[model samples]
Target: MLKPKRTAGSRDLAAIEMRRSLAQRIKELTEEPGEHLTPIPGLSLYHRTSPTPCFRASYEPGLSIFVQGRKRILLGGTEYLCDGWSFLLSSIDVPAQSQIIEASEKTPLLSIFLRLDMPMVREVLSRDDIPEGPPSAHRQGLVVGETTVGLLRAAMRMLELLDTPEDIPFLSPLAHREILYHILRTPQAGRLRAIATSGDLVQRTGRAISWLRENYAKPLHMEALASTARMGVSTLHHQFRALTGMSPLQYQKQLRLQTARLRMLMDGFNATTAAYEVGYESVSQFSREYSRFFGLPPIRDVKALKNVNTALESVV
Candidate 1:
């Protein structure tokens, strides 16, 4: 097998130094304890001063570059740990549970999150220079890959634009493109390319997933979903599970539960109110499943989550 011009071994030494450089800039820019949106569109810096409780999160199509500490995320049955050496590419919107596994006031978890430009990715994939590889069997929306020197360099340059605000207007887009190019150069690009392509099976499955995400509260009809994806019922089910690791019903259930949890926790809704609001017909059914899913009854879970942040307050 022919390797790319910059092999894995070649990028290692430089990537180590580059990660340190990027981490410093990110930490300095994100003085607050949460995600800080940058001047550049679709880019954000995250800083966590302490390990956190597992929280439900929805990851849009983006890249998460971790430069310090670690995070553990569970998507379906798979558990992924992202530390300083790696990055996670989300080719589609995915619901998961994530927690900060490593961090402290002295050494915070520093990361850069940049949303993908599917059009830009498609443009790069169209270039004559990018060789067509054999079809990849990989279909998961989220994939982890080693952070290369090129990726770190691109992210650092993007972050630097924060200092010179004027340059960001003209230069940030170029930096964003550069970051996308580095992502395409990795093996995980195969999954990204599938989503970017117009009519690929994975892309079709992505459409159904998107529909499910947007309309999870509505009654699900397999025929309508298969029609949306331009796939037969069996084919849709197979490809959907292949790409998302969850059946459509299972996916919708999780989405409903997470949304209900958020409403109750953040919006001050009660258990019964939150249940019916998220399309549940019965409060008893919602409570039963909520306990099974979150390991606590609704009121208790919300109460526990409220206190979960107390640990971080001490560090502040």
Candidate 2:
């Protein structure tokens, strides 16, 4: 069956304009070289220039829409590309690498990140009459969807709050809730549904993912995890791979490697100690895997990161 063409409503157009305005506001705020941390609580704006591959963790689940450049995020083995016209939504905290694919000194990658809140998501889901989805299947945690006017408008309204600090304390939550409501009702609702509706297989798989993130270095017992997620082992495996683009084990390995890298950078832990901390047993095995993943040995990679930090500090 063919899908019908989706149209943006008047409200959606308003959202686009609002995003443009917000982008302008962010640019104005950051006339100098530094990140502009928005005054709005739980929300932030990102502006990056120099083209390079940087790894980031989505600590807060939110929507990332770029107005100027493109970003490629590797979640598990699957890759998602989001540009000006598309939005990337990740509902879970998964370790990933995002590279700036397109950016220039003139037109940098301009983006607005709305920090998603569990209370707001649940509140919207409570009152809204969201459409019933097909029998739940494992849905990917991150997806690239065509932007809609309605979605954009809600974001714009939320951004407008930045200019009025007093309004934020009372109205910000309401605006954020409206955004979630719009998402729940849009065609992209499936992505929201896969995560929003709890206890379904996909939701269960999400729980499993949360567990892996916190217990990255620990042994992954599928049966035990499945039990915790209220799913069977077979079902858990299928859903976990489908949503994350990698099996549970692969996801765990990535987390371990990323954590070890951070340890080396911040605490000056050597390869052996860092490996042990992140659950690797043999020193040789840790170095081999670290090299394969990061393109350099632990010590070399740490040194390179330190140098880069120094250079950035000097410029700042």
Candidate 3:
């Protein structure tokens, strides 16, 4: 028996239905307005009732898909905006600022985040079925792309495991693999592939990044960094800047400033204490740098952040 041919209209309708299904499932999983961690490892859901102040945080390698509303992420000097039909991928650990740009009490921002498993990514790449692409040298570690039905369906199924807890152990891996497979085939594949490819400049830059992260408080020696990355000094500087959009020293400064802010905000450390703790030799220099980075002096910024938190707590 011959099967009926599918029409373009039918395909369009099916895509619409899938989007609706994804939105419904995501909303169901995120019932309240907060970050919700799930039973599955490295999977989380987020919701917000209104527009939020820009948030500075570091993102590990992961994928974030918004089912409702929009977000803007700032990496160094670049800005990326994504809506319900789009997704963002961070191929490496990066410190960035992001904010929910579109949301309301009635139609809050709902989103899901899945951390990428590098081992699984390598496994997929090792398969002979996967196609090869030109190696990318200067691609940033972050990418935003419009979503497709196949990717949406896979993500929805991964979320569905939240309701069917019993099936998660067996089915979650498969769902995650499917999601990665779709991502690998996207235009961002070259950058993503380069992150995992051995001896690639991006991978070497990543090694340098890892060392900086681990030794951020120590004095930065250019020769040491170049040796750690197994690259020449000039190549390390150029490739590191190309991949991360900042010089190594600038990146270290970001790490130090962010860490100091967290210590002051969360650990009740004072400006001088926090500054020195993160390797700032001079309190005045720390204050100057902190003000430049966070738009206020250390003491004032901490007070402002505390007030914002207090206001949010009162609202909640």
Whichever of 1 and 3 has more lDDT, that candidate is: 1
TM-score of each: 0.85, 0.76, 0.81
Best by TM-score: 1
For model 1, residues 20-48, the per-residue Cα lDDT tens digits are 89988987898777989988989988998
Residue 196, candidate 2: alpha-carbon lDDT: 63
> What digit string (tens of lDDT, one per residue) describes model 2 on residues 258-308?
889988888889888999999887889989988998899989988998887
Winner by lDDT between candidate 3 and candidate 2: 3
Candidate with more favorable, higher TM-score: 1 or 3: 1
State which candidate, 2 or 3, has the greater TM-score. 3
**Model 3 TM-score relative to the real fold:** 0.81
Error of 1 at 84 (Å): 1.6
Better of 1 and 2 by TM-score: 1
Candidate 2 Cα lDDT to native: 0.72
Q: Please provide, for model 3 over 76-164, each residue's C-alpha lDDT reduced to its tens digit, 9 standing for 90 to 100.
A: 67788877767787867776777787877677788889988888889999999998876655377677766667888888889888889
Better of 1 and 2 by lDDT: 1
Q: Candidate 3 deviates by what RMSD? A: 6.3
